[model samples]
Target: MVRRWKRVMAFLIAIIFCINCVMNIGVKGTYAENSNKDSNTEEVHTSAEEKEDTTEIEKETTSKAEKNKSDGDLSVDKNEKTTNKTEDDESKTKAVNNTILDWDTYKSKTTLVTVDDTNKRIYVKTGEALTLLSNCSAENYKDYIISLDSSVTGGAIEIPFTYDGYEFKGLGTKECPFEGNFNIANIKIQSTLFAGLL
Candidate 1:
């Protein structure tokens, strides 16, 4: 009976030992799996942070590029405006230079004669005499006489005058009657003849 009881106790001890071993193994496996899961979560969090950082960096780069492009466009626009204004000013200066009249050549061919307070006469050589008046009034003796000989031929003439804030150009031919009196008012006259013994 004593030996049988000893064998039974020994078997129970062995069975308890096996069960404790199995329980320890299960606990270790559970701990290892939890550790691996934690490591994977840390890796995922780290990757997400890196992705966010890259996205921010890309956005900043794009913003900087856009700002630089806007600045470049503004500079180009300013340069174009400056160049256009410079060209416009140069063209206006050229136009003003072109419009300046040369008076030296005109003075050699013309003579001015003052008649009275109201009448002034321009006498060319046997061609046409241009008359100038100070006011818009016509009187009998206020007329201008241009004397020409019978041998003078006929040609075209231009008479320039200013009256009432306007400039006037009178076209005449020397074939018109010359032994007559002419009247002009409010005018400064310049006459040129193309022909006729003048």
Candidate 2:
């Protein structure tokens, strides 16, 4: 009986030792794969929308519109430069054949330049680290994905367009244009008189 009792205690001690070793070793390697499972722990999951919200940058639009009555109706001062809308209209009518480029920014991102020849309108979208040249209309669309250079990731731009510039698409640094592919959906060759008419 004494011998049997001693054997039982020894078996229990060995089992406890194995359990401790597994717990410690699994934690350093793959805890999830551990043989000792804990069922009481709650799982955490985050949705794609939540992930996107976290990645978004804070932006403040300069527009000074009136606040809601609940927030205290305070009128914002009108922007002086925004009145350049009139000048933009003038640019529409004064379209010269010469291509005008405003791509002198120090940063890079995705850019969408949409040309509507029939309506004589242009749309621009620039996003973070992206640039694209596209020819599109209200109904149909085509992209100008030049060399697939990944560096030219475009932005979601909503700025006003400069008048009378031909579409040109580019990607990567000038020294490394082949980093990716670049494509221009369409090209328009115009003389000084014909460019403004389109």
Candidate 3:
């Protein structure tokens, strides 16, 4: 019975090899026929209209390049003015309780909402608004703590900014609920629980 099984396996292998050889020959013939046809085909000639179109495209591209160059010069002037304004703002800023405060403008008597990078905290002064940096989302600072400073009992923190289409309603905490909508609730507490489970 073992000898019979070995003979059958050898026969199947031989048949598969013969089938592959036949398929290869047929594919080679098809490719050779296609190449011969391609060689005998006529060359394409562009019309006068096509040549004019190509020139127009080139002209449009050159004009766009010139416009971009002019825009770059305007951007350089804008950058200079921006740098001067930033230097002025820095000179006017004052540090209080290890947090940088931008006293340029504040709502009512409230202070500016500033980020404490060292302690990974964001301080939101009551009645003042907090607009996060560009390309930043609420989930980006999930680990950072929020410190609210309110002189009045009913004073609320307003977040009226959006980042990359994500609205900044607020990240509500149990102690200090948000005045408007919120995307997350007590992210720190949730993260702590998840870590404990792990």
Candidate 4:
């Protein structure tokens, strides 16, 4: 009877030890799985944050690039306008040079007229005189009319003509050749003879 009791006690002790070992192994495995899961979650969060940061940086770079392009376009437009203005000035100068009229060849009331190139005026004898057409009676004079102030010797005269975009104006003698100032638009011509006459 005593031997049987000892055997039964020993068997119960062995069974309890095996149960404790199995429980400890299960707990350790669960803890290791939880640790691995936490590490993976942290990695995923870090990756998501990096992606967001990269997206923001890309957006900023694109915005700056677009602004620079618009500035460049404006610069190009300004340069083009300047070039066009320069070309217009050149064309106006050429037109004035090509339209010089010789007072000797011009058919006036009398041919007794003398031109002073240095003084930019015309002088006629006391007995004879010259004349300029003061009316818009020709086909080429359709844009404007001429008005001469006979009271003043060197007064402003409203002449008719336009070259490109310049209005022709002159101040000269109504009974003699051009004896005062002539201008194309706002540019004054320093010559005794009329320019762009029809």
Candidate closer to the true structure by TM-score (higher is better), 1 or 2: 1
Question: Roughly what TM-score does model 2 have, to 2 decimal places?
Answer: 0.16
The clash numbers for all candidates, in the given order, read: 0, 34, 0, 0
- Candidate 1 lDDT score at position 115: 36
TM per candidate:
0.37, 0.16, 0.28, 0.37
Candidate 2 yields a Cα-based lDDT of: 0.35
Expressed as tens digits, the lDDT of each residue in 1-198 for candidate 4 is 999999999999888989888888888888889888888888889889989999899899899888888988888898898889888887876664345334444324234334444544444421112223222112222232222223335433322344333333332323333333322222223333343333
Q: Candidate 1: where are CA atoms >4 Å away?
A: 78-198
Q: Which residue pairs in model 1 clash with each other?
A: none
Please, what's the RMSD in Å of model 3? 25.2
The window of 10 residues in a row where model 4 has the poorest summed lDDT is 126-135
Model 3, residue 192: what's the lDDT?
19
Residues 97-146 of candidate 3 have per-residue lDDT tens digits of 12322333222223445555567655555322444221133333455565
Pairs clashing within candidate 3? none
Of 2 and 3, the candidate ahead on lDDT is 3
Question: In model 2, which regions exceed 4 Å deviation?
Answer: 31-198
